[model samples]
Target chain A: MKKFTCIVCPISCSLAVQAEGGGDITVTGSKCDRGKAYAKDEYLAPKRVITTTVKIDGADIALLPVIGTAPVPKELLRTCLRHLYGIKVTAPVRMGDVIERDILGSGVDIVAARSAVIKKG
Target chain B: MREITADIAVVGGGPAGMSAALRACGLGAKTVLIERDAALGGILNQCVHDGFGLLRFKKQMSGSQYAQQFADAVYESSASVMTETTVLKLIPGECGSKAQSRQGLYTTGEKTGGALIRAGAVILAMGCRERPRQQAGIVGSRPAGVLTAGAVQKYINVEGYLPGRKAVILGSGDIGLIMARRMTLEGIDVAGVYEIMPSPGGLRRNVAQCLDDYDIPLRLSSTVTEVHGKKRVEGVTVADVDAARHPIPGTEVFVPCDLLVLSVGLIPENELSRDAGIEMDPVTGGPVLDNFMMASVPGFFAAGNVSAVFDLVDYVSDTGEAAAEGACRFLGGEALPEYVTVRAGDDVSFVLPGKIRRDLPSSALYMRVKRTIENAVLEILADGKPVYEKKHPIVTPPEMVTARFHESAGSGVPDAGGLTVRILGD
Candidate 1:
């Protein structure tokens, strides 16, 4: 049995999961249904949303913040960030503008968090 | 001199100030918000992290996205905002005098020649500042590479500059934990995060997501004893501390790093409040306020980090609304009743709103613990008589707890000597 803290809410329920080799698991100490689902997903396939900044050209600010539209595999987070660091976008981009699609074959698009306008000289 | 008059004046344009201004305008009071920065978002602009607005918005959002929601509301409201304008001085208003009505003076903009604002009420929402290396008592040669966690956030997230290839962070607070993850993402190697206390200072979720997820080690009962760089930070010396937090000799270990980030703590910005003759709570390091959020000065109010360091932005916004309502009531000539002093007792670090009104409706008392405890019961006593008690599985100093009390819960007990909140082991 492995112990984990459910991050679905501020309650932070401590869950104990016992997993068998044949794709079966038992969860204990969850106060709600969300905690159970969180434990199952965490044990089977953990995922997390990646938020980071990317360099921008021709903008008032030097970097623009971006985030993956969907949760990506936890193991591929570093790969996704490395790919993001290599790419640079231009200004006049909208908040939801897509910077990259299907990042690292994770089927998630990285989108801008805020609009950046070109600085007038 | 140019004079701008409004019913209510809000200082600072961060989450607290924006919410206060919006709530004041919603209460039908002409409100004016003054911001020193060029924009209204304040520090939220560079906070590009997620997990904000979880409680209030019911969904996780980025700091800028959460701030933009409030900023857009303020722009659509009737409140007038003055950006790039700094409030230089706050002159107390006349109170209980027949000659002139109560109106406070707000001097803004230029130092010598600036606009004067007279309002019926003033709300101090000026946020807190991070404790730097000097404040943390880290003896070292002054260098260019020493930076606060907030500064590094701005440099990387806003300016797109890699401060250094290797970094050593002192203090395991939220900012330090988040920055460790951020630096790791940018290809910077974080040596470790050292905390003097046995327990981490940041939230458990942050420890899990930011540190544990990134395979970063958290060194507890340890601290940075010295910085080892002259021109720029070349390294830092880490040492273990005894129970008394005294440095344990001969245990010093030196690690090489170019950047040293400090996330020690935050001090509430209360210079204006102190200058305005408001009584302050030594424990909170903020103004002593009553249940209505009114300071000792009759027409002056305070909220947000200016009132006390808060862990959550949602609570800051809540205080803003509460202070706004208090200001509205003051403007409507509703006199507050006598107050009952509230004190912190055993295992309790401090409590916000040092006093409570006799006729208050329902109020929440926010407090922190001095140390971590398990299976504890938090009790609220009135004159040594228990009025409220609640059980908790675990309590830590990093997270602030709130205890609610109704009007009939003896919070307004007449002739009550005092009210105290304490934590007792179960």
Candidate 2:
């Protein structure tokens, strides 16, 4: 059994996670339904973001915060990085700008996280 | 496609939705509150923090307590609160959008779609959604552990789960800072928080109370460049970004961690609004409204996060009450002055209630900065006349700034017909 705290609300509950007889984890100490679902997801198939800076080839700036639209599988993050090597974009990068779509064919896009100037210097 | 109606239909059930519903019902309007979730509380239910309710309740309380206050008020007001009711579309009715259709497989007996009651006014308090890593342009490898700060909050606070044992946060928004402290209490090592800007995206109190007090390291003018690891987030590389947002060649280092938490920003949920054909401002991501907070549709009004993202729940409640009353007043056939529109000028990032009715009962201006400035004076301009200006000590890009232009601040203005707010630096 592992003790954990729920991160969904401020009432971060001290929870006990134990593997039941059927190889399933049971979560205790959730304050609400949302927490309950989150606990289950955390125990099974944990999801998260894919963020990285994309190199802008021609812009005065070197990089921009690029991220995937959704969480890729927990295992595929490395293969995803191989795709961005030597990749670059021109200047005047806008927030929400897409640098590469379906990056590495991983069903995720590398998008600009913020707007940036191409360059004047 | 069925028609359903109420005396007053409130969209959303967060602080604003509840406040509006309670006020409308208190004022004797048959109210219907619609929420997209199975529960009534909007983001508050997930916010386990205790800083809320300072202004309205006159006491600092937890988000749940604050939400419960409205919940109890709602119950006593005898308002009909519908959970998991996503409003599919808004069509004109006998009052306005007299004919409307909502789709839900369940709630047929309890909800009874296609029923008619005929609301005279409508209040929209749909709240907002967080901007994802894509929207924020966070750089890194695709990994399993990075989640939005709010999502992290939901996972840890609500469900009793730990997202990670060691974590790195991108963006110092309130949630990120709050989570920084939260992770510490859980004995999780918070690797660091990185922001491209020199300042934070949250309030001064949050910085001092949540981060400084906890001994969490917050790096400014820095950003993460890549996510490392094959399956889970093993670590990230932090680098300094120049004034032009370029990575400095020599300023890169790798910080190993299992989780990355994002506290970027929020976008108002406007899908239903768009389906209803309400006009939206591209910048604010919400419906343009008259001073009454009423949208372009005559009887349809918006408030709270649905109108624009706000820093405080107090403001949400304030706007929510206004929307409720506005709905009642409209339904009662109250006459309003023709509203003139308000615009955010060059220095301004965006303003809420993008439109103003000529016949406004009361007006409140909410705004954020296009970027950070210091030692500035706020100038409220009306038809090119300086109406209200105040000296400010410091301003940051992320923190929202608010100044009221009620009757008290009147500068002998003749153009009460139309007005706008502007900021100038000393």
Candidate 3:
């Protein structure tokens, strides 16, 4: 049995999950179906969207904000961010432009959150 | 001085101000919104993190994305917007007079010293500001690297500069917790988060996602006693505090760090409210409001953080709409009925709309608890009789609670002496 708070909503419902050896799991204390689904996935394989900034060269701004196009495995967030920190892209980047595809082989693309235009020298 | 006239003037172009301006214009009022910044989103532009607009939009979105939704609406509406404009002063009209006589002193470019804006009504939504290090009373010399959490956030998210390589956060507020995760993602070392309260000041989800997920240590009942540095922040002294929040002697431990980020708290920005001669609530640190969101002066109204700090932006928008409706009613020349005082009882901190107009169709009392409690029952009493009650699994100070009352509920009592809200442990 494991206990945790469901982050699916602001209610923060307290959840308790009990799993049998045969992969059977029962989640209790969830207020909504979303919480139940979140708890089940959290017990099985947790995933989260990682948002951060990446360096951009020859742009009006020094950095561009980016986010994972899809939720990646929870444990791989740090590795993904480390890879992103070391990389830099030059502008004419648009929102949703993929800076890195299949980041860390997690099958998630890191995309720009906003457009950054090249600065005229 | 140049003179401009409008039916409604909204100060501050943040989410609250934009929503209020839109609502007023939708009600057929000639509205103008003044924003001090070049853009309209205000602080939301710098807040790029996700988890906003869940309540209003029913979908999770980033702060800037949520703000853009409102900003787009404001742009499409009939309301006129003045960017890069500052309101120097608010001059109230005759006390208890109608809504059309008030005037605001404003300035646009540097060359234009000042201009006068005469409006039927004014809605103040300037929002709150971060409590700086000096207000926290930490014994230390002034240093460069010492900055507030909001400043660090703006620098990293907007300016795109890493403020420091290593940092120690002084308070465990939501901003500090979020910054802990942000700095960690940027490969900055977070020494630890020291909070003076027994429990975390931020939301539970923030504690879990921002601090616990990143392996950042959260030390409750602890605080930074002193700062150590001559030029830049070299370190900070952490110590545990006693029940009275005084630092216990001989428990100081020095931790080395390059930056000291203060997330102490927020104070409602109410300079215009004060200058307008509106009555203030000392406990909430904002103007005293009525059920219609009107200040003591009839034509002046306030909402959002300019009235009081709110936990969620959804509530801020709600208040904005309410203030707009109130302004419309005042402009329509509707007579106000008798007002009943709303008081805070045991275990409750304070309540917004200190008074309620008996003629209102319905009124909602927003309040916070003094402390965390479990298995509690919240009750609203009128003339020592319970008028409303609701059971809660748990309640915390960080989360605001709202209770609604209709005029029909008080039909029997001709003149309810007072209404009080209390939280009782089960």
lDDT value for candidate 2?
Answer: 0.72
Clashing pairs in 3: none
Q: What value does the lDDT take at residue B379 in candidate 2?
A: 79
- lDDT, residue A105, candidate 1: 83
Docking class of 2: incorrect
Residue A2, model 3: Cα distance from true site in angstroms: 4.9
Candidates' lDDT values, in order? 0.85, 0.72, 0.84
State the TM-score for model 3. Answer: 0.91
Better of 2 and 3 by TM-score: 3
Tell me, by TM-score, which candidate is best: 1
Per-candidate TM-scores read 0.93, 0.72, 0.91
lDDT of 3 by residue, A1-121 (tens): 9877788765788899999788799999998899999989988898888787788989876677777777899889888888988989999887678999999889999887666678977
- Interface RMSD of the predictions, in order shown? 1.8, 16.7, 2.2
TM-score of chain B of 3: 0.96
Error of 3 at B352 (Å): 1.1
Report the lDDT tens digits of candidate 3 across residue range B294-404: 999877888888888888888888899999999988888888877888889999999998898877878878999999888889888877788878888778988888878
Writing each residue's lDDT as its tens digit, candidate 1 over B1-426 gives 778778899999999999999999999999999988766877788888888887798877787776777888998999999987888778777532421235555565653247777888999999998997888887657977889999999888887788999999899888899899999988899999999989888888788878877889999999888888789889988999999998899999999999999999888998888888888888888888987788988888888888888888888888999899999988888767888888998999998888988777777788999987878899988878888889987788888888886658764473456678999986
Q: Mark the regions of model 1 whose C-alpha exceeds 4 Å error after superposition.
A: A1-5, A10-16, A28-33, A56-60, A86-109, A115-121, B94-113, B409-414
DockQ of each: 0.55, 0.01, 0.40
